[model samples]
Target chain A: MTYCVAIRVDAGLVLAADTRTSAAFDDIRTHTKLSTFEYPGERVFALLSAGNLGTTQNVLARIARDADTPGATASLRSAADLFEAADYLGRALVEAQQKANGAAADGVNLEATLIFAGQIGTGATGLFLVYPQGNWIAASPETPFLQSGELKYGKPILDRILRPETSLEDAARCALVSMDAAIRSNLSVGPPIDLALIRDGDLRLSHRLRLGQDSPFYVEFRETWSTELAAAVRGLPPFEWEAPRAPPAP
Target chain B: MTYCVAIRVDAGLVLAADTRTSAAFDDIRTHTKLSTFEYPGERVFALLSAGNLGTTQNVLARIARDADTPGATASLRSAADLFEAADYLGRALVEAQQKANGAAADGVNLEATLIFAGQIGTGATGLFLVYPQGNWIAASPETPFLQSGELKYGKPILDRILRPETSLEDAARCALVSMDAAIRSNLSVGPPIDLALIRDGDLRLSHRLRLGQDSPFYVEFRETWSTELAAAVRGLPPFEWEAPRAPPAP
Candidate 1:
């Protein structure tokens, strides 16, 4: 299980994911779920994934292998646009899933879901969510964010804060808080957190961070959010006919 | 789809639920999912349910009909304690689910989950989650909350704020916020919200509220939470080398 979210604001795109991967309760391990590909001024892309680890690894390997092939015209490097990249990735994802489940009998779920966001050219930024079934949907002004795996627990904050006009840094913070909410509520979404920021019109990632539990800024970010949320809850108008809250018992 | 949550604290118990029920997107309806049975000076119970509406209605009807039977020793009135009440409710749920699906051949889900909290006597308050299969588990101080249907979206706040020493008023407020988060994130969950509060060491409900979208306090609660949550996201510490966030476009 995992939680990954990506937001496309006017300023650019922001993507975040947790590092925990759990095969079973006792079989948990840390695996980075976000990868970035930068061709400097030509193009830049960030891919975040969740679901069967093997399938994700396999799809990603195919993406890297094809992109690195000399004179390749069908790889990420040669995609006509961001939409084509997502479509290509979806095909790779389907192939990987089928290959993994081909050996296992029935009940083997080797599906994976991914968020693909990047700038294919100047003024051409896009975000998409590729489903396990190989279909995909692009984000629009009406829906500026995409998520995969354990998405609901983190959706409310995104619903309230994300907009096409939101600043890239603000969107990154919102993504982190959303991930923090998922991590706090579910063990399967542990940290260190992975975040990638692609500033508008830039052809490379402006920031790529992996914040562990003890990272100074990460610690302060989470603590501040927890305190602020508690204060917010306390500040809400009370129901009519309610008395003042009493202090806790000793 | 429904969203229901119940919290047990030192002061008492708080339960809240959304009323939206959707069999299909076009067939949406509103149905109250929380009920209270108060035998003043003897016992009190608040039940919150989620899943199949027909199955829940059937189970509740049986509960009411059986409890009303004269000389009955196996109804809600006859339960010696909260555990017995929960066990009884689980059996009723299983029976109802089976009956509803018995008419269909297969692939028809008729299951419902319930949260039952009550006090049979002084110092006898307890909370239990009754599963669809006639099994149940009590909520201890270590885990003083039980939720049914669309639970994850509302859980992070509870994981952070609920404890044995929490005031019932605060717990109730938290419950409403939890419900608000679910409503904001999903169309399957909507208003009016139903909330029930049971004070410990008492034999009757202290508060029972049905809040609609237009309800003054409910509207204020949602608006304030949204404002404060956005502020929280904006207040998080920025990463190294980050630029100041720009204001929204005019």
Candidate 2:
């Protein structure tokens, strides 16, 4: 399993994914689950994927191939808006799964879920979680985010902290914290984590980072969070039966 | 479905469970999932349950009936130690499930998972997760907690905060915070939350709390956590690209 999340705040979009993939406990591998397509100042789209690795790679290849072909009618570059871009991704996902399942053994699953997040021309910045069925849902000011794969373990922080009014930096930090929860509690969702930031209207990537398990910056981030959280828990109010503290010195 | 967790620390044991139970989304009901049997100063045991409510109730009834009958030979009251108590509960659970499943239509499931936690006279205080198969595992110093049902969402905090050396109050608070995470992120695991704590040498109950969604103490606990967590996230060190700040004014 994998864990990926995309947050759409007013300032920009934050997309993140964990890189671990496994067929069995003994057969684990690291693969990038994040990909980007940018036409600097015209359109920029990031894809965060989860599920069957083969199907995800096939879908990504199709998207890239169509964008490169001159006469290809529907591609990320040709799509008028983010919704159209998501539609193309959904169709590609469905087609890839169908083709892969055709030659697979019975009971094997080849489904994939991809998240499309970026800006297109003058349209508002957006995020969409494209389903395995080729259907999708867009993030709005009210929702402001989308997630796929081993998601529940990391979701409470996102639910509590994200909002349209939140700063781009804060939203990005929230995504990392959310992923940290998943990575710590679950074995299937490991790192190096991939993170991308696309500021609204820039129509280009602002920052892209890969944080391995030993990255100093990432290690500091985790340690700081742990220390702060321990302090926070320590400061919680004492129970009713515990003796009340005297008022603070004047 | 339900969510229940039992934490065993050197200080004693902290046991908690959410009260929401449902056969379908529309068929929700409230039922206590924490049960306690104490022969004050001699022995004490608490049962935290998940899975089929009918089977759980049947097993509890059997335990009660056997304990009340003089010379029934095998009941919570008759068990020699914490492990023996767990064994009695496990056998009762299997018996209950087999009887329920035999009378039900095909495809029906009545399996339950139970955690037996307490101490017997002059022995070590203990916690055991009794399986549907009548086997069990104890919570040791290294991995000091056991959780059942919709457990993943609430697990990260437990991993971060629990230990044998953690104080009884801190461990109890950690259990509440863990329950808070599950209650916020999930529909199936919810309030009112039931909590019970037993001190290492005291055979009788230490504290028993039932926190409803609207309970003032629970509301305060949730709010405090939310506030502290938000502050903690705010205190995280900024990324490299952010402009460096000047020293604080004296």
Candidate 3:
């Protein structure tokens, strides 16, 4: 299980992913789930993946392998727009599925979900959630976000805090808080987070961070959030079952 | 879908459940998932359920119907301890599944979970998570919590805040905060919550609340938590991305 979220706000986009993956309680391991494609001022695309690691890694490897191949149908570099780039990714996923289908006959689903977002040119920014079938949906101002992996645990914070007009810095912070909440609750999602920020129209990565167990900011945020939450809970008026009743027979 | 949680702390026990149920988007409705059986000064048991409402309702109805029946194998009234009551409830769930198996073949899953907690005799209070197959596990100081239905979204807060020494009042407040988080994130878990508190050795419920959309405390808590979380996020130190050197002129 993993938790990955990407937000498309007015300020830019915020992307975050957890590193823990587990086959069971005993077979847990840490693996980076965030992949980036950058071509300086030309294009920048980030992919946060969840589901079968083998399938996602294979899809990513295929995309990277095709980066330098000219006229190879379509590559992230050759795509003229974010939509085309998403389509190229979708195609790569489908191709990978086809190649792995024969060995995966025990009904193990080789599905992988990708949240792809970034800029392809000046004044052009896009965010898309790509499915295992290679189809995708672009995020709109009304939604403003996309999540994959073990998303349910951390969704409420996003729903309540995210907005189209939210600042990039705030959105990124929200993403981290959301991830923090997820990691605390779930064993399958642990430390060492991958977070990225892309300012609208920049066509260059604004921030890429790797937060591990010892990250000072994360430790402080977790402790402070817990303290404030406890305080907030205590501050609420105590509920009474019934208006003070006199003792029956002392 | 549903979200029900029960916590056993030093002060006592806290139980909370959401009311949303749906077969599809258009087929959604509200139903109470928490049921209470009170023998006044003798015992008080609260059952919070999730999954397959039909199955749960059937299980409850069966228990109520057999409450006064003589020699009933494991009726709650006949149970000598809270553990026996939990076992009875789990058996009732299995009975419900068997009774509905034919109907289930048409698509519905005749499965449900029950969180049963209360006091029996002069013993300490106890809490158990009952499975559909007549098996259950009691909450201990080591774990101290149990949740079912759409559980992932709200689990993080519980992980960070819950402890064996947590006060009953504090646990109740934490439970509500957790539910609020779930409601904000998941469409399948909604308002009109069922909340209850049981204090140790009291043999009577301290607080049982049916909090709805119009509840001022709930509304205020939700607003306050969201605001505080956003503020906390902003307080975190910002990521200092490495600056790139000047690129060649176009």
Best by TM-score: 2
Give me the displacement of residue B146 in model 2, in angstroms.
Answer: 0.6
If candidate 3 were superposed on the true structure by all CA atoms, what would the RMSD be?
6.8
Isolated chain A TM-score, each model: 0.93, 0.96, 0.90
TM-score for all models, in order of appearance: 0.90, 0.97, 0.87
lDDT value, residue A97 of candidate 3: 80
DockQ (CA atoms), all models:
0.66, 0.74, 0.43
The alpha-carbon RMSD values of the candidates against the true structure, listed in the order shown, are 4.2, 1.7, 6.8
Docking class of 1: medium
Q: Rank the candidates by TM-score, best first.
A: 2, 1, 3
In the range A1-250, model 3's lDDT, one tens digit per residue, is: 8999999998888899999988789999999999988888888889998988888999988888788788777888888888888888888887788788878978788888899998887746888998989899999988889988777767776787788988898788789888887787777888899999999877788888898878886776677677765655555555664344354354
How large a fraction of the reference contact set does each model reproduce? 0.72, 0.62, 0.55
- What is the full ranking by lDDT, best candidate first? 2, 1, 3
**Candidate 1 per-residue C-alpha lDDT over A157-178 given as tens digits, one digit per residue, 9 for 90 to 100:** 8888888988888899899888
- Record all residue pairs in model 3 with backbone atoms less than 3 Å apart, i.e. clashing: A153-B152, A153-B153, A156-B185
Better of 1 and 3 by DockQ: 1
Query: Backbone clash tally for model 3?
Result: 3
Q: State the TM-score of the second chain for every model.
A: 0.92, 0.95, 0.90
> Where is model 2 chain A poorest over a 10-residue stretch in terms of lDDT?
A241-250
Cα error of candidate 3 at position B208, Å: 2.0
